[model samples]
Target: MGEPDVAANFFAKPQHLVKVNRRRRMNIWRSGQGSPTVVLAPGFMAVTADWARVQPALARTAQVVSYDHAGQGFSDPGPLPRSPARTAADLKAALVRDGIEPPYVLVGLSMGSFEVRHFAHQYPGEVVGMVLVDPSFDDMAKRLLKVTPSDQVWIESQFTHLKRCELAAKAGDLRPGTDAYAACVFQPQPDLTEALNKTYHDMSLQASYWRSLASEFSFAARDKADWPLADMPLIVLSAGDRERPPRPPEEVEAIQRVYADAHEQLAALSSRGARRVVPNSKHAIQWDRPQAVIDAVREVIAAVCGGPA
Candidate 1:
């Protein structure tokens, strides 16, 4: 099959294509209206549609923005090695180009936590507060490695699969009925419409999509020094029900303990920061426990407004 028509059936709702640079434009969605604009950053390999459950509710109270990273959704492909710093810079450029002024509340899900944190570090004065949903902390890999050396092996194995997918996509072999298609494309999500699911699957078949995924995955496994939050109003939401990968029960328990401790430490990054464990939820807390994510954003917005949190 040839490239899917991304605009024909997928954009039922309005979206803006903002130029992050002369050569690249990112897809952005905006809702509601007010100051301290709330920005939603999706997790690794996730797109703006993943925030369908949470963004509208938060938008009711403040302006909310969500976008797909380059090569991930409707956006054009960007430069290689999609590091956190590069993602962070692209977000800043998109917001500016879209004319969304800051003094903003940033909400990051999973790997997105790294991008938003890097954004805050790069433009401290622009961000008022943050909410990290089931965030992946810096040094998490190292801490997990200390827990079990097999963690490294697991990480490498994941990359191996990703590389295979990348090669298959480049070869146009990620088609229906093939093992590559089955392994590379995710099953349809209950929350998305049939058309949206098809859009996601089409994107999955593109070489650029897998390239971005692999690049981000590589950077995520590296050791990045932790930066200071410096008393910013922040909240770290942890998924109480973590989905375990294929591993020994004892190893899983040890890893969970390390992650729990790290979550607590992440919350303590700011004097105003706090940790909330969303029970019965997995890593995608925004989908499983959207209210928790919404409430955290509300609290942070309130804190930024100097009101009750």
Candidate 2:
């Protein structure tokens, strides 16, 4: 994707920009009041608003902090060539700068789950709990390669599409799937405000945002092999009702089995980790079954607080 200067006239409302470092300013949204803050980490190309449905509910019990990583939403574009380690470190720095005290319960969705794991592994003492929502696995690339011959095509097509998005953004033309991206990432529900809808659409059109996403996916598996085994309260929330693409039944089932196995392995990372399959929900569990996300967060919060789990 073509690199562009950070948008000057992006957000309407006044928001806090926590300086994670001299070069990066991370945008963070906070609500509620309590110890053991619940941090919401969004998926690929997702912004803080993606957690709109679940954040409010969790805020009722404990402090909730939802943030956009560098190059997403209104956050400043970070140094190029982003990796999960850099993202996690930036998040930790921002949290410290914002004065959000720890004993934190991290809630991560999709690709964001890797950053959460990195944070927990790097700063085990700061994190008390975790909720992984339809997490992406470390060995996803290797597994997809072995699935089928077409899987290779699918993987390559993602990079191709990302390049096209970059070109379109540079030419001031919104990408073909901008609407679909907005609908999936931001407007998880039907009643999204017109202003919010427009914000998501604008963000989706940025070439820098797509480039950051591409970089994250490209190097996700490299540093993930040495994943740590932490002793903390962890919940692996898997989607029980994921949409099946048009593929042979055997291949589809094989992919699903691999997903199931990966999630189970994630749960085993912690002695306190447990796996839960949310019925009638897909990858975007925060949108389809927000209550599940809220419950998982609360369960973790409770565990950390020595309350009923």
Candidate 3:
């Protein structure tokens, strides 16, 4: 059997550069030819290439496009002060710049979900529906702190470090995926070892950009007025396994509970949406469990493409 390669050539190519903001230029990847477009967003520390698992599945139904975010992969080093809203704004610009009209099905995974919600809120009219894979609500992180402030602070600090690593990776200066990220996600896929290793190595180099990015997180952390987009039609997928190593079983459970609550928060956002659990998957559900990602996306597309039903 052939190994899964999310970045495999599928007769698609990047056609143009969309200047999203002062410093962000989104590299748009495209495939298929149809209406009711679908735009994809990469996860934290991952470039658009991460969707290598599911993008082809989506291209069959609609115009599917994914891009590396600024300071992440294939994109220019974005301006400082990047947040959920700012990222969403960059997405809107990328879509427009690429000639992908509105009324799109925006699919985001993990960290990408945060930005997806912001995009739906910013351009509700343009978004027809959404698919949130292992979603993350802004307050989701805060839940961790509730248990023990120290734990939250530790995670916050870790997240800060990873974001820095991501920037370095984007600049082609270091590795991309971390060891933990690899052990949990990449190692499962033996076929993409070389590519995965490349991504992992690339992400490792982004520490150079951490200082400026740290400030952006503070601003992005600020809450938006209302979650108008949160209520948009969405399909949220959850991972079955939520284990963090070296931590006690109880500690792992606590993290799962936090993710569970976040999932509930995500489901609560939409009257027209539903949630599903992707079994035996990790944070990188799309890569670790590609079929689940495809299945969830199909469900969402069906709802959107379903005619008057």
Ranking of all candidate structures by their lDDT, best first: 1, 2, 3
Using TM-score as the measure, the top candidate is 1
Please give, for residues 1-309, the per-residue lDDT of candidate 1 as tens digits.
Answer: 221133334443426788999999898878889989999997888877778788878777789998988888888899987988899899999998889998889898998888888899899799989999998988767888987887798899888888899999999898889999999986677766777667777888888998889898988776363677877889999999999967789989998898899888888888888999999999999889999999999889888898853
Pairs that clash in candidate 1: none
Greater lDDT among 1 and 3 belongs to 1
Ten contiguous residues with the weakest lDDT in model 2: 1-10
Clash tally, candidates in order: 0, 0, 18
**Each candidate: RMSD to true structure?**
4.3, 6.1, 5.3
| Candidate 3 structure quality by residue, lDDT tens digits, 18-44 | 877656577777877776778887665
TM-scores, all candidates, are: 0.92, 0.87, 0.78
Regarding TM-score, does 1 or 3 come out ahead? 1
Residue 251 displacement in candidate 1 (angstroms): 2.1
For model 1, the stretches where C-alpha displacement exceeds 4 angstroms are 1-14, 186-192, 223-225
Candidate 2 lDDT, 192-278, residue by residue in tens: 555555676667677787777778767654446336556788999999998786789988888898889889999999889899999
